[model samples]
Target chain A: MISFQKFRIYINKCFIALICLFSFVVLLPFLMLIARLVKSGLKYICLDFFTQTSPSPVDAMLANLAGEAIPGGILNGICGSLYMLTIALVLTVPLGILTGIYLYENRGKKFANLIQYLNAVCYGMPSIIIGIVVYVSVVKSFHSYSVLAGGIALSISMLPKIIRTTRETLKLLPAYLKESGLALGGSYTGVILKIIMPAAKGGLLTGILISVSRALGETVPLIVTALGCSMINWNINAPASSMTLLIWDFFNTPNMVSMVWATSAFLFSIIICLNLIAKRIGRQWKFILYHE
Target chain B: MNKNHILELKSVSISYSPGSYALKNISVSIKPNAITSIIGASGSGKSALLRSINRMHELYPNIRMQGEILLGGKNIMEMNPVEVRRRIGLVFQQPNPFPTMNIYQNVLSGYKLNKIYLSKSEKDRIVEECLRNVSLWDEVKNGLNKNPLSLTVGQQQRLCIARTLALQPEFLLMDEPTSTVDMFCTNRIEELIYRLKNNHTILIVTHNLAQASRISDYALYLEKGELIEYDKSNIIFVAPNDKRTEKYITEQVE
Candidate 1:
C-alpha cells in the first residue's frame, strides 16, 4: 500500500510538471511577439515618431541613403485613431449596456433568447465582413470615406462583446440583492441605477476596457470605412487614418516598411496597459460581493 | 376586511405555472405591532406567502397571484408595486448588503433608492437610529465607511435589517432571516425581532419550530401549502387543534 501511494504521488508530480510546461508553451508565443516588436520597433520610437506625420516614400528613401531615421512620425494616425475611438466609445457604451440590461432582465423570454443568439452570431462574425457591410452602407451612400462611418463600424463590432459582459456580470450577482432593493420600495430604474449598477461597476469597467482595446486593435473595418488619410484630417466627412492603417500603409510601401514595427509596438503597449488596468480592477471588485 | 387587523389576505393563491399552486388560498389577518411567525416544513410555501404580501411574487416568470391582499384597508393587488413594497419591507434568507455600499450607505439605501433627499444631519440621525435599533451601532460605529461585506454574516444580516428599517415601513417581512447565522446571532436577532413588534407589524417565515415558539406572539402552522393551525403561540405549541400540527410538533420535538 505504501509503495502504491508513492507511485501515485510520483504520477501526480509528473502531471503537474507537464501541465506547467504546456501552460508556459502557450504563453511563449506572446512573449516572443512582444520581444520581437520591441527589438525591431524601439529605434524609430523617438519624439519625432509621435509628433510628426508619416514620412513620404521619397523622403524616407532619402533618409535611408543618409543612414538617418525617418523624419516624420505617426501623429496624424494617433489623432485620427483617438477621434474615431472617442466616437465609437460614445456610441457603443450606453447602447451596449442598455441592451445588456434588457437581455438580462428578460432572460428566458423568446425575444431575449433570439436577440442573444443574434448577438453571439455578430460577435463571431468576421471583421472583414463587417467592414464590407459598412463600406457599402455608409461609405457608398455618402460617396466618401468618413470617420463617422469608421466609428459606426467599430461601435457595431463592440456592441456584442459589451452586451455579453454586462449581462454576465449582472447575472453573477445574487438575485436577492435586486429583490432586496425592490423590497425597499424602490422603483425598478432606481434599484438598477443605485443597487445593481454600483455593484456591477467594476466588472462593467473591466469589460468596457477590454472592448475598448479590442476596438482599438480593429483594422479591416477601419480600412474599408476610414480609407486611411495621409494628412491629419479633422473633418468627419473626410477619410481618416488610424494606427493600424498606418501600419498597413507602411507594410505596403517598401521604403516605409520599418515604420510598421514602431506603430505596432505603440498600439501593443496601449492594449497591454488597458488589459493590466482591467485585471487590477477585476481583482479588486471580485471579492466585494457574492462572498456567501 | 377586519378593522382591527393591519394587513389581510383574502383567499390569496399563488401559482408558479399555469395549473399548479405554490400557495393555496392563504387568507390570514395580521395585527399591527405584533410578531407573527409562519412555520412550516420545506416547500410548504411559507416564503411564497411572505413574498406575495410585498408584491415580490411578481419577480418570478409566469407567477400568478389570485385574491386580494389588503394593507391598512387598501387592496395591495390594485396598488402600485413600488408603493406596496415601500410600505412593507422583505428580508431574504441570506444577508444581502449592497456590496459597493458602506455600512452607513446600506442603512440609508432605502431612502436613497426612493430619492428622498435627507440633509447631512438627517442622514446621520437615520443611520445611527436604525443601526442602534438593530444593536449593530456599537460594533460598527467607527467603521461606517467600511464595506458591509466585511462584517460577519450576523452583522451583515443586521445591517440588511437596518437598511429595510430606514424606510420606517409599517410592516416587515422576513424569510429565514436567521437561518444562516450562528446561535448567538440568532438569539440577538430574535430579541431584536421581538422588540421591533412594538413599532412595526412583522411576519417571519421560519423552519425552526423552537424559534417560532420562542419569539412569536401568534404562530401560523402550515403543511403542504395549507394553514393547519393559527393561534396564540402558547395554545398552538401546547395544544394544537389539528392532528397534523400535533404530529409535526411531536416529530420536531423528537
Candidate 2:
C-alpha cells in the first residue's frame, strides 16, 4: 500500500500537469495567429512598403501579372492613423484623468456613483455602435467624413477605459499619502498636482499607451467615420485613411491581398511593443510604490 | 484658566452620522511645549479627538463637528482650514515618505506643496536642519538623493516627522506614529517625541500604555467616545481617580 504522502504528491503532480495542458490550449490560438502573420507577411516588408503610398488596385494587378512587387506603401494610411490618433489622445487623456480624479475625490457620493455607472455602460458598449453614432453626429453635421470624426469616435471608445485605469491606479495608492500632503498644509489642488500626480505618473503613462494601442487596433469605427482617402490628406476636416481601413481596402481587392498581411504584421508588432512597455512600467512602478 | 492652556476644546462633539457621536462633548486643555498622549481602546475615539484638533475629519463627507477649538486665544473653526492645518501638522500611523521623492525632496515637500519657493542654498539648509533634528542627518546625509522608500520603515517615519517639522507648525498631531515600527524604532521615536516637546505641543494617540506612561507629560483616557480621565501621566498611571481608567490601564498592561 502507498503512504498518504506519496498519494498526495502524485495528486499534486497530476494537477500541475493538467493545469499546464489547459494553459497551453488557451495560448495555442494566439501563437498560431502570430506565426501565420509572420510567415505570410515577412517577405513583403521592404523599404518601399513604408515609404510609398499604397498602390491603386489596377497598379497592384498589373504588378502581380508581371511578377513584380507592389509598387507603393501604406504611407497615406500611416499618416492618417497618426493624425487621428493625435487628436484622439489629445481629447481623451486629460478629460478622462480629470473625470477619474473627480470620481476618486467624490467617492460614495450619489452623483459620482451615477457617473461611474454610466461610465461602465459606456465601457461595455460595442465599438461599431460608437462608430455609427459618430457618423450620425459629427460626420453628418460637418457634411464630410473627416479625420476629426474618426478621432471623435476613437476618443469616445478610449475614454471609458482610460478613466477606469486612472481611478483604479489612484485607488491602489494608500490613503495616507493624500492625508499626509494635506496635513503639510497643502491645498487640495497643490497636493494632487505636486504629490499624487507624481506618484501615480507611472500607472497613468501605462494607461495612455495601452489606450493608444487599443485605438490603433479599432477598424470598424474608422470605416464608418473616416471613409478612407485614396491619397495622403493632412487636413483634419478631410477624408482620412487609417492602417485598419487600408487593410480592409486591401482585403476587398483581389491582387492586393498580400498587402493585408503586411499591414496586419506592422500593426501587430506596434501593439505588442506597446503592451510590453506598459507591462514593464506597471511592474517597475509596483516595486517602487510598495517595495524598498 | 485660558492663559494656562495653549489649546482648548469647548464641548467639541463629533458625529459621523446625523445622531450618534464618535467623540462626545470633549473639553480639554493642552499645555504648551509638552507631549500629551491620548489612550483608549480601539474605536474609543482616541483618533477622532486627535484628528479634531487639526480639522482632519473634514476630508470625509457627512461628518459634523460641533463646538469650538481655541488655538492661541483664537477659534480655529473660524480660521481657514488650510491655515489651521498649517498651524497644526499631522503624522500618520504608517511611514509614508512620498514614494516618488528622494530624502532631500521629502524633507522640503511641505515648502514645495505650499509653492513657497526657496533658493537652493536655503532649501539645503532646511533639509539639513530638519534631518539633524530627527537624528537622521548623519545616516542619510550621503544619500539625500536616494528614495526615502529605500530606508527602513523607522527611518521613513523619521523622515515624515522631519517633513512635518520643516513647516514649523505650532502643534504636531501624531496618530500612533510608531505603531508600525519595531520596539527599538519605537524607543527611538519616543525619544524624538520627548525631545520635540521643547519646541512644539504634541498630541499623540497611542495603543501602547507603557509608551504613554514613559513619554507623556499629560494623559487623556477615553471609553466609547467619552473622556473618562485626564491628568498628569504619573497620576493616571499610578493613582487614577476613575475606575474605567484604572481598568483600562490594568487591562492594557497585561
- Give one clash count per candidate, in the order shown: 1, 1
**Which segments of model 2 are wrong by more than 4 Å?**
A1-15, B1-5
Clashing pairs for predicted structure model 2, backbone only: A52-A73
Off by over 4 Å in 1: A1-21, B1-5
| Alpha-carbon lDDT, every model | 0.91, 0.92
Q: What would the DockQ be for model 1?
A: 0.77
Across A1-292, the per-residue lDDT of candidate 2 in tens digits comes to 5798899999999999999999999999999999999998878999998898989999999999999988899999999999999999999999999999999988889999999999999998999999999999999999999999999999999999999999999998878889999989999999999999988988998999999999999999999999998899999899999999999999999999789999999999999999999999999998878873
Q: For all the predictions, what are the DockQ values?
A: 0.77, 0.77
- Fold similarity of candidate 2's chain A to the true chain A, as a TM-score: 0.97
True contacts kept of 2: 0.81
Per-residue lDDT of model 1, residues A32-140, tens digit only: 9999999999877999899888889999899888988878999999999989989998999999999999999999899999999999999998999999999999999
